[model samples]
Structure formats: structure tokens, C-alpha cells
Target: MSLHMTGAGALEDPICTYPGSRLPVRAPCARLEGRYLAFLGGSETFGRFVATPFPALLDRRLGQTCVNLGSINAGLDAVLGDAGAMRIAAAAALTVVQLPDAQNLTNGFYRVHPRRNDRFLAACAPLTELYPEVDFTEFHFTRHLLIALHRHCPGRFATLRTELQRIWVTRMHRLLRGLGGRGLLLWLHDGDDSPRSDAPLGSEPLLVSRTMVDRVLRQARGLVEVPVTAAGQLEGETRKMDFGPLQRPTAEHMLGPAMHARIADRLGDAIATLQ
Candidate 1:
């Protein structure tokens, strides 16, 4: 007996089949001409939940086209090495870079699937060629390295942590410098209080302290920081700002609509400093 398949039902050779894909519409103002702004960071900057992200709000406020190059689960290595990221960095008149929590560090650069929304997976790209010897893999590396050094040499870890922090501050300074003296804003998103039982804890709150803030400020040539948390000083107000219930218990891990509006207002104030 002979059997045949035809039309859309026909079995086609894999080699002959067209691969499916869609090109991302280069976000308007990719060239950064006219009034332009660029927001670069990880998931939060990408605006996971709300229909409009803070960058879009800022774009509306400033009357400038804001190009968002934020990627979900992206670490510093990915941000620094991506050609498209670099393009956005180079073209912007103003840029906002939100540093991810120390816990999210990774050693390699990665890519985001445009259609998948918030999904991210490991990228085969090597970032060390540009960064050189810097391991962006784990946030605890410094803590562990310090412990190891202390165990091996005694009283060496403190010096080492300080040195590592200095290196990070310096690298950040250099990154800002390369933006052609454009306004560079650094926004920190951390709770003022100690990590609640429900939150994932990491790297012991490096930027939450005033000393670290001063150190970072000294190194940065043109940097603006928006402080999100303050322990005890504004406890009542901060507690009122919590969005835990608003975030879908099973699905969401970020700020909700009300919290985002507050953040947008604060961010707008920071952006106003550029003016």
C-alpha cells in the first residue's frame, strides 16, 4: 500500500523548513538623536509587571525617547559586554543603571529572548575577554574568599574585602566616565530593615550603609544615587509601602503597581537633578 501526505499536513524535511523568528523592533531612538534617554539594568528596569515601567514614565516626563535595554536576570557582565547594550550606552544623553542585588552575580554574559518576556537562560558568550579575570559568577565570592584568606593567613580578609570593594567602585566609575560625560544615575533597591523571613538574603547589604555610599560617591565622577531604604528612621512609612500582598503570591517577585508608582515618583525626582 502507498501512503502520501500533502499540503500543510505533509511531512517536510527539516533542512528545507524555514526557521521561525521575529526581529525586535529596535526601540525608538536607538541612535539616541534628538531628546534621548537610556535605562539599563536587569528585570526591574525591564518593568516585569506594570504596563508602563519607570523608564517609560521618565520618557513621558522628560519628553525624550527612552530606550530600555534592561534584561531579566542579567548581571553586570551581560550589561557590559552586550553590543546592543553598548550601543544604547554610547548613544544616550542620559542613562540610568540599576545595580542588581549582590546575589544575582554571574560569571558570563547572556541574552534575552524577545518573545518570552521575562524568561532568561545562560548565554554561551564569554565576558572575560572585555572585563579580564573578573569573576561575576557569585556574590558570596568575596565573603568566601575573605574567609579563606583569613583561614590561610589570619587577618587578611578585611583587607581583601576592602580591596574588592574598591575595585568594584573603580570599575563603576570607569563605566560612567565612558558615557561621554552624560548624566549617570545609580539607583539602589534594598529594604531598610533586615531581610524579612520571606525575602531571599545575600551579600549582607553592601550599599545600605552610609560608609559604602560615601566610598562609591567618591569614586564616581558624575553619579546620582536614589536611596530606597533607611532603617528605623522611616519605619512606619516604609512598612506602608510594602507590596507583598499585591504581588501575586505564586507568580510575582517584584514591586506591584502602587509601589512602582512611588518608585517612579522618587526616580523622577532623581532625574530632575540632571536638569
Candidate 2:
């Protein structure tokens, strides 16, 4: 596949694709040679605004090749459905699978875009029936659709939440099993000490909870929970992120260099034990 550069962050992050899949991942990609670590997740794992994501930092720290397969706004569908990404992860020395939000996936109630999991394609029959009063046509993204649904009726939203969570667990299990026991579940949340059961709408990893994580915990090598600490949420560090003028707001919401360094530090230790 051809290599191209796109300005998703401060630098011109190179976009590359694998042989069997068209999924765009960050480049300077680890060649399929000797032992390497693989990372799979959404924007955080992709390191949207930061110059060096945790995977790259670990690459330098551990002196090992680390292939970052993280895609922007990736869900289980985007990760598991990619033959190319999965092939790399399964063969890696270890794979870090980021816990994606339950909302950005296809469930019984709605269908999301196959690759861009955050894009809402269409509502399933069940969803329409449940929200007959809602006009799903107005929605373009999963987060907006979900927020509207909850506002329209929190009671009905509960039912939808349950289903999303249920399917998230099922799909996550499938992902870990596919890794052949080399997967490590990564729970990367910002601005909170722990994942809450009643986490607000639009929260990253939407509708996922500690209990949900535990359900799939034992299936992988282990779980790495990195909660962006109270101090980490400050505005000072976020200023270090590289981005164009329009991307500043987004950069502020994303993890900055310090947090990425911290994640690299934590992951390096964990990966060392396994190596």
C-alpha cells in the first residue's frame, strides 16, 4: 500500500496500511521482522495530538520494535475486523488492546460504520421500535445519537446501555481469544480516578465500567488501567501538545506528552516482566 502523510496532530503523522487491510495506522511502523510489541486502540492509543504516543515511547525505552496499530476512533469492530491489524497483533511479543467504548460498535440496536466505528450509519429495527418517537436521521455520530437518545428517554436508554455493554463484553472476549493469550487489556481514561457506572454521556470508552472490564480481564495476559491523575488533567501540560490552531481544543482534551511518557513508563515495566 502507498504511504501518505496526514496532519492528524502537530507533526505530519504518516498514514500506512497493511497488505490485507486498508485500516490507516501511524507510520514509521515496526517492520514484520524480529520480536515486537503491538498496540491496538482508539485515539488515545493513536496519540492524536501528541508527537510520540506511548507505543513509540516504549519503543525507545525498551529498545524493541513496537508496532502501533491504533486507529483514530477505533472500536472492537475497527480492530477485530481488520485482518491485517489482527495478524500483526497475534504474532507480536505482546499486544496491548485498548478498551474501546461500547457505543462505537454495532449492536442489536444500531449499526456503526465498519471501519470508522464512531460514525452512526443506521438504526436497527430494534432501536427504531424502542425509540419510535426519535428521528434517527438527524444523527451522524454515535455520541450525538446516544446523547439524544438518553435525553429523549433515560428509561429506554438503560435498556440500550445494557445491550451495548453485553455485546462489548462478547466482542472483547473474542478479541483477546484471537490474540492467543498475548493480549493485554489497556484501560486508559482521563480526568477520573476510576471508571464510573454512571459515567456521563460522551465519556471516552462510553458505557464501560470496572465490572465490564473485569469480565474480560482474565482472558488476556493482564490489564493495565491508566487513569489520567488529577494533576494530569491540568491545562499546563496540554499546552505541550502539537496541533494546528483549530486542533487546540481537541489537544486540550487529549493526553499530553507528560501523560504519554507516564503511560510509556508504566507499560515498559509491565512489558519487561513478560519479556
Candidate 3:
């Protein structure tokens, strides 16, 4: 079946503008000051449905300068390619790298895409005419593809996943180290499976399992997990979200605003706890 869900409206908010196809970053002076706390991730981190994202909330709570380097449809390469982001990271007192779901794929480095932001090119310059094919839409499709391919052709997918994961981990290590070993690397995932048995062999597990969680943790210096489905603040609420009409599962069913709020709260707490 197609992973694309039908019938949900794109959540509308002031935060959803693209400078080119790349998501825009709030001006540094307006949002950051002193030692930096940079948030890196995809749409969720960009605060698609909510008005104030977690990084912004964290800034308000701590009264410290924080930058939201998040982008809609952002993959790993986007993070590595933003020069302003890198400069901010290199200067931050605390850096929080919020990893997105592994379904997102990015080549080891960032390349200039007509749809991408100029900041990316400003960050990393290269003389290469070739670019790899990667999908920048639909998480489910990407995940399903990976799972199906892995299950049907184990060797290739396994090798690809291993290499990608390693590259992700290593790049992260370098980013953190470059920040002077004083940042927290936190992975934010929607609970979706257990580590071993949850492989995309045939079924979709509703929640992330301990084993898979541990594996993600193992890849980081420190970790924090927040489940949108189970966060206390969102236990019961009537507020609804619209995920655009073209998406399936509807907006209310897909991602509730309460979930985003809880994520923000959790991220805030995580940032506060960092040494």
C-alpha cells in the first residue's frame, strides 16, 4: 500500500515559510544571545503545528540565547550544510541536536539544491556536479521502502543502514566535539518499535521499544525521549490540528497540538538539565 495518507490539511502557522524550498531560520539576533543552544531537526523541530517550538520555549524558560536551526523537510545534510548554523554551534555554550526519525535520508554532505537555502551553500562549498537521489517527502513512504527493501533484500539494506547510521553518529560526534564537549545530543522519536523484532520485515509496531531506544541512545553522548502519544499534558484534550486535506489519518489523528506542547515541555526540561 502507499504510505501516503490521504486527507489532512497542512498545519498553518507563521513559522512555515521557505526561503527557497529550505525552511527559514529566525534571525540570530532576534532569537539568540551569549552562549548558544541550537536545535537541529526536521518539521517537528521546526514547529509545524504549534506557534512556539520547543527551542523557543526552552529559550523563554532559561532566559538564555537559543537558536532554532530546524527546517521543514530537513534531513541530515541540511544540518551539516548551514554555515550560520555551524558558526552558531561552534560558539554555543550548549548545543541540542534533536535527531529526526531514521526514515529521513541524506548524503554525507550538503549540496546546493535549487530548493535549499543559500545559508547551506555559505556553510559548505564544494566542486561536485553529482547529487544522490533522496526523497524529501512522506516519512511513511521512506520508512516503508527501507523496511520492505531490508526485509526482501537483507544484505543491501543492512549494509546501507549500518553505513548511514555510522555516518550520522560520526558526524554528530564531530559536531558535538566541535562545540567543545559541552552540549547534549538528544534523540526525539515517536515511540514506534522495539529494537530487534521491529525491523520493517512485515508489520508496523505502534510504539518504540526499549531495545530500539537503547540503540539510539548508544549512538549519542546523552539522550532524551518524549512520546507524543503518552505525554501527561496531552493525556486528554479537545484541541484539534489539521494536517492538510491531502493527507490521510486527518490532522487531529496524526499529530495533536498537545503532543507538540508536551514535546516542547520535555525539550525545555531536557535543556534545563544540561550541564
Candidate 4:
């Protein structure tokens, strides 16, 4: 499939597809070449709107080939299940795994699309049995379905949130194990990690807390998290970003140059220990 990684430019980006990976990655991946770094995550990792995403910034900073293995709205299932993506990540000198929303993963409660984790597929018998009054077919995206469910019945949604958190923790461990010694877990969010009971836990990264992320690291200090500043949120130019009219709103919400720079700095510092 032809993936649009950039807008029409005077100098077109060399983004292309390589064997084994479903999503188009920043080209010249150098999968078989010298010491390289692998960055895996959702659209933010892909540098959706910013001229330089964190991986690209890190590549220039470290003077290494940092392969962009970003998948749109991706979760553990897509990366872990794909042999080619895992192959490149495992082979890399270091791999940075971005923590996606807790709601995107496939769990006992509900199943997301295999390739598009954001797409809500079908609720399992248990979820349906839990909310027989709700029509699962009424939703397409995971967030939408979850919001409606939460509003309709907060009591039942709590159970689902707990399950998602439990699954996220377990699956994260499994993902780290698969990536081996080079893998570093990254949590890139827009705000603080302070826990709030009323925060929509079923939304993007719904119930995940600082403690949970710390649990994944286990005091290893391998995790690199960067919360964007309020000013940084407004930093972006349409000229640097790529998207259609329908997607303009979403592209606006992506990380801008300032945030990318911050993330890259933290990533550079964190990856130094890996070397």
C-alpha cells in the first residue's frame, strides 16, 4: 500500500515500504546496515505533523540511522505479531517502544483491529454479557465506543478499565521480553502523569498511571517520558505537516517541533546507557 508520509514538497521525503512491515517507514531504513536505532509507536512517533519527529531528531543527534517504525494508532498486538517489524527492532542496536493507549490492545473484554488498533471491531461475549443494553455496532473507533459506554454505565465500564490496565501491564512485559536487551519503553504524553479518578480512563491511555509505567521499568530507569508543554502544544506550521482537509483537525493535535526536540533530547540521554 502507498503510504503518504509527507505532503508535496520541493524535496520529497524518501519514505517507502520495506519487506515485513505493513506501515511505510522513513526510508533508507538501513535494516541490514551499521549500528542503528529503532523507534516504534503510533502517529506521533511517525512525526506526523512536525518537520522532525523524535526518531529523526535522535538520528541526527547520535549520528546513527534511527529507523522510524511508527504505525498509526498502533498497539502491542500489531508490533509483536509482525515478524518483520520485530526482526528489525531486535536487530537494532537499540529499540524505543512508545506506549500506546491502554484501550487499543486486544483483551478479553474487546478486540481491536489487527493492523489498526484504533478501530473497534467486536466486543467479546463477556463484554456484551456485561452490557447487553448497549449496541456495540454503533461505534467504529475505540474511544467513541468507550465514551458512550462510560456515559451509559460507569459501573460496568470500571470493570473493563481494570481489565485493560491489567492486560496492558502483562502485555507490556511480554513486549519488552521480546525486544530483548535493546528495547526501551517510552511514554510520550501531552500532560502530567498525575492520577485523577475522573479522568477518562477508557480514553487514550485511559487508566495508565505513573506507577504503572514505573512498574514496567522496575527501577531500571530505561523508560523515557516527555510531557509536552502548553506552549509546545501550539507550536506547529501547516507547511511542515501533511494531511487532507478532513484530517486537518487531528494533525493539529500532533506534536510540534518544540515537543519533538524535547523528546529527542530525553531519548538521546536515555539511549546513552544502552551503549
RMSD (Cα, Å) of model 1: 12.1
Candidate 4: Cα lDDT at 25: 60
Per-prediction TM-score to the true structure, in the order listed: 0.55, 0.90, 0.64, 0.86
lDDT of 2 by residue, 62-129 (tens): 98889999888778999888888898889998999988989998989999998889999999999999
Predicted candidate 1 versus true structure: per-residue lDDT over 122-167, tens digit per residue? 3324433433334434323333432333454434334434444454
Models sorted by lDDT, best on top: 2, 4, 3, 1
TM-score of 3: 0.64
Off by over 4 Å in 3: 1-23, 26-29, 107-141, 190-221, 230-238, 247-255
Instruction: Estimate, for each residue in 215-250, the C-alpha lDDT of model 3 and write its tens digit.
Output: 445444466667665222344432443244543233
Query: Largest lDDT belongs to which candidate?
Result: 2
What is the C-alpha local distance difference test score of each model?
Answer: 0.47, 0.82, 0.51, 0.75
Summarize candidate 4's per-residue lDDT along 1-275 as a digit string, tens digits. 12353353223334566687776565545556887888888767877645667888888899899889886677778887788888888888788888878888889988899867889998999999999999898889988887788888988888988888888888888777767766788877757566455656522355678767877885233887777643224644554655555666676677767778888899898888678
Q: Between 1 and 3, whose lDDT is larger?
A: 3
The positional error of residue 131 in candidate 4, measured at the CA in angstroms, is 0.7
Residue 60 CA displacement from its true place in model 3, Å: 2.6
> What's the lDDT of the predicted structure labeled candidate 1?
0.47
